[model samples]
Target: MRKIKELGEFGLIHKLSSQINFRASDSILGIGDDCAAYPVKSGKFEVISTDALVEDIHFKLSTIKPETLGRKALSVSLSDIAAMGGTPKRIMVTLGIPKKISVSFLEKLYSGFNEICNHFKVELCGGDTVSSPKCFFINVAVIGEAKRIFSRKGAKPGDLVFVTGTLGDSSLGLKLLAKNKTRGKDHKFLTTKHMDPTPRVKEAEILGRSKIDITSMIDISDGLVQDLHHICESSNVGAQIYEDRLPLSPELIRTCKRSSIPPLPLVLNGGEDYELLFTLPADGVKNLIRQFLKAKVLVTQIGKILKPGGISMKMKNGTLKVLPESEGFNHF
Candidate 1:
C-alpha cells in the first residue's frame, strides 16, 4: 500500500474520489475544483466550499487570538468560493472544542465570525459544537452563487497568467510568529497577514463580471507554483513564470533580508496567501489590467501559458528551471 505522505493531499483526494461510484446529474461539479457547483435556477449556479483548521497544525491558541482564528477559518473557505468566481451568501460552522476552553473564548470567537460575515453580507445560519479529545478545530463551509463560473480547465497555450496582490507575505508572517520574534516595524504587518488573511471575494467578483474573458481562476491557498500547476493539469497546458515579474511587498522583502532567507522559494512554495491566481487571453490582458486599475485593485502579470504541460520558472539571468509538480503543502 502507498503511504498517504507519498500520495499528498491532491493525490489522496483523487484516490478517494476514484472509489465513489455514486454521482448524480445534479452534482455538476464534484471533488475536483475549488467548489462543487449545482444548478439552482435559470442562469445561476450554487457553489459550495469547505475548509478546516486544526489546533497545532493550522494555528496555536497561545500565539493567535480566538476571534482571529474564527475569522481566518471562514476566510479561507470563502476564498474557495471566490476562486470559482462566486459571491458568498451563507455559511455554516462546526467546532470541536476541548473541555477546558472557556465560554468567554467561544463568545469572542463567535464575535469574530460575525464581524467577517457582516462585512461580506453573508449569513451564519447554524452549526454543531462537539467536545474534542485533545485540541480545538474549526470547519467552515460557504455557499455562494455565480452567474458565470470560472474553473481550472479553460487556459489556452497563449494565455497570460496574472496574480492579485502580493505573494509570500502570509507564509513569512507565519514563520515570524512561530519564532515569537517582535522587532521589525513591518513585523506586525507580516504577523497580521498570517493571523488574518483576507479572502479575494471582491476581486474575483470584478473579474467574473468583466468583459475580458478570464480563461481560468484559482486562489493561492497553496503556493503560486503549486496552485498554477493545478491550472496546468486541468487545462492540459504548461506555464512559464518570470521571477523578476513576481510582485513582492516591501515588508516581505525587508523581513526576508533580516531573516537571511531567500524570498523566491517562499514566494513559489509558501502557502496561505489567499490571493487569486488566474489566466486570460493575451489580447485581453491590457483591458483587464486597465479595469482592475480603475477599480484600484493591484494585479500583476507574472507569466504566460504554454502548449506543453509542465511548470517552469525563468530566472533573472535567463535560465529556465523546472519546478517539481508536488512542491507545496501536503495536508495528509
Candidate 2:
C-alpha cells in the first residue's frame, strides 16, 4: 500500500471518493462541493457537511483550552455550511474522548459548544461519543437550509472577487501562541481569532437574501489563494488578485511588523480565517458594496476572475506574476 503522506489530504480524498459511485436522486450534490446537498420539498436545499479536529494535528491542549477547542471544532463545520449561503439548523457532534481526561474538562468543552449553538440558534440534535485510547478529537456534522446555493462552479471570467472581514488574523494568532506570547491586547485579539473562530452565518444569510447577484462563494478555511484556486478550478477560469487590496486587521499588521514577518504571505496562504470569499458580476459590485455598507459589514474587492486556468498576483509596484503552487492545510 502507498503511504498516505505521499497523497496528501485532498489527493487521498479524491482517490478514495473516486472509487465510490453515488446515484441517489435526492442527493443533488455529493463528495465534491462544500456540502452534500439534498433538494427539500419546500423548494430550498438542505446542505450537510462534516469536519473533524484532532489532538496534536489541528490543535494542542497546552495552547488551547478545552472549551475553546469545542467551540472551534463546531465552528469549522458550520463554516462549511456558511459557504453555501445556508442557514444553520442543527449540528451532530461526535467525540473521540480520552479516558485520562477529566469529566470537568469535558463539561467545559460541552459548555463551549452550547455557547456557540445558542448564539447561532442551532440545535444539537444527535451525536455519538466513543472512547479513544490515544488522543482527543471532535467530528461535527452540520445541517443547514439554503434557498439559493452558491457553489464554487458558478464563477465566470468577468466576475469580481470579494472577501469579507480581514484575513490572516487566525494564522497570526497561531504564530503568537507558538512563541508563547498571548497576554497583550494585540496578542489576545489575534489569538482569539484563531482559537475561537466565528462562522459568517449572518453575513451569508444576508447575501443569499440580497438582490445583488453572487456568482460563487466559499469560506476561507484553506487560505485565500488556495480557496480561490478551488473556485477557479471548479469554474474553469483563472484569477488576478491585487496584493495591496488584501484586507488586514490593525492587530495583524502590527504583530507582523513587530515580529519582522511579512504580512502578505500570511494573508495569502494562512488558513482558518473562516471569512467568505465570493464572486459577483461586475455590474452588481456597486450594489453589493452599498448593501454591505448598509449592513455595517466589512468587505473588500481584492481580485477579478480571469480566462484560461491559473492564478496571478498583482503586486503594489505594478508588477504581475503567477502564483506558486500552494498546499493549503494538508491533513496528511
Candidate 3:
C-alpha cells in the first residue's frame, strides 16, 4: 500500500474517513462540517472548535511578528464559527513556548489575541501554558452559539455557490515574503492578509440573521477548490466553477502582475484566505447577489452544485477541464 505522503492531504483525509467511527451523541455533526455542534438548553446549540499553530511550520519567526502570530492563531479558529453561521462567545488558549522567547514577546502576542477578541466581543475564559523542548506551539479553542446550524451535506443540485471577498492575495503575499523583496503599493495589504487574516464574523452574522436558507457553508482556510471538494464529497455532488467569474481584488491582480505569477494557481490553491464559500438555492440567487452588492462585499456566482461525481472548471475559451487534486495543508 502507498503511504499518505504519496496520496497527499486530500487522499489521506479520504482514507482516514473510512476508519473513524463518528459516534458522539453530542456531536450532531463532526469532521464534515465547519464546527462540531452539541445540543444546549433553550433550543440553542453550542459549537466547539480548535486549531494549532507551530513555529517554522504554519509560520516563521523571521518574517511574522509574535503579535500577528497570536492574532492568526485565534482568527483561524474563529473562521470555523463563521462557516457554521454561528456567533463566537468565548475562547481558551494553550501555549508551548521555548525558553529563548522573552516575556515582552509573549505579552505582545497576548495583546494581539486580546485585540481581536475585543473586536469580536469574545471573552478569554482560561488556558494552559507550558515549555516546549524545541519550537513554539499555540492552540486555541473557541465556543460559539447557534440556534440553527449549517452543514456541508445540505447542498442540493442546481444550487449556486458563492465566495466572500477576493482570492489569491495571501499566496501572492507569501511569495513576496519568500523572495525577501517588496513592492511599493499593495504590499501592506497583501502582507497583512498573510500575517493577520480577518474572520468574516459580521458578514456571517448578517447571513445567519437574514434566514437566507443557506444550503452549505465553509471558510477558505484550505484552497478554494480543495475546500469546495469537502462540500461535494459530503453532499455526494460535484461542481463547475467558471474561471472568468471568480472574484479577484485589484490588489491581487496588481501583485500577481508584478510578481509575474499566474493568478489561477494562487486563487484556486492558496490557503488561509479566510473568506466564506457558501451555496444557496437557484431561486434566491439574484436576491442574495443584490444584498451582497449592497453590503459592498463582492459575492461572485462562480459555479453550481451537481449530482455526485467529479469537479470540472470551465475555461474562457469554452472548454471544460478537470481540476487537479491537491491538499490545502497537512500538519504531519
Assess the local accuracy of residue 32 in candidate 1 as a C-alpha lDDT between 0 and 100.
58
Q: Which pairs clash in model 1?
A: none
What is the lDDT for 226 in model 2?
Answer: 89
Off by over 4 Å in 3: 1-41
Q: Between the candidate structures 2 and 3, which one is better when assessed by TM-score?
A: 2
Residue-by-residue lDDT tens digits, candidate 3, 1-332: 46434555445434433333324344454444444454565877788899888888888889988879878899999999988989887676777867676655766687777677778877655566676888989999989887778877789989989998889888878878888766677887887898889898877876877758899999998799998998898888899999999888898887778768799988888888999999999888777867777788767789999887778899999899887547465445
lDDT of 1 by residue, 9-104 (tens): 455445434433334345556555655555576788889888889999999999999789878988999999999999987776777867666655
Q: What's the CA error at residue 188 for candidate 3, in Å?
A: 1.6
TM-score of each: 0.87, 0.87, 0.86
- lDDT, candidate 2, equals 0.84
Off by over 4 Å in 2: 1-41
lDDT of each: 0.84, 0.84, 0.79
Q: Which stretches of candidate 1 lie over 4 Å from their true place?
A: 1-41
